[model samples]
Target: MAVTYLMLARLPEGGLGAFDAYESAVLPLLAEYGGRLERRLRTLDDRVEAHLISFPNSEDLAAYRADPRRSAAAPLLESSGAAVELLAVRDI
Candidate 1:
């Protein structure tokens, strides 16, 4: 079964750029693990950003999470002071 994720990130004013850089670097890594980015959105005020991501299965998603490339980008997120939330979701 496929699995989907809803990621909501609260960005700090100073860190938004850093967060964007992080996403640019890491989002592409999804393909290596049978994953895709369905949608990405951001508030006009730039305070929040959301992403809809899907993977073939939970295992693939887990592997993506463990990928060193993604891990290496952690500092970008940390420096951006972004608070992130990821949730599993389903389409009705």
Candidate 2:
């Protein structure tokens, strides 16, 4: 299995709204491509949010990353003013 962690920093101004839409709309679409959200959290101290997504393997992760739904949601996320930092890990 493989896991991808996304640390998201919402853009100033409309961050919360954007993050909400992303969680409601975009994250669900990832499941259709074999991705599952393992964890999600909002950090008060750092003023950022984080998501941990898992896939069966690298191929599945790739599929999720390349999915049209993900692509479609990009603009909405951008409009909402959000940026993501991604980290990937492979299970032993």
List per-prediction Cα lDDT, in the order shown: 0.95, 0.70
lDDT of 2 by residue, 1-92 (tens): 55565555645555677667766777777777777888788866435777777776778777777878778777767777666677765445
Model 1 CA lDDT for position 47? 94
- Candidate 2 Cα deviation (angstroms), residue 48: 0.7
Best candidate per lDDT, number?
A: 1
For model 2, which pairs clash? none
- For candidate 2, the per-residue lDDT at 46 reads 38
Deviation from truth (RMSD, Å), model 2? 2.6
lDDT of 1: 0.95
* Model 2 CA lDDT for position 32: 77
Off by over 4 Å in 1: none
Error of 1 at 91 (Å): 1.4
Q: Model 2 reaches what TM-score against the true structure?
A: 0.76
Residue 15 in candidate 2, Cα distance off native in Å: 1.4
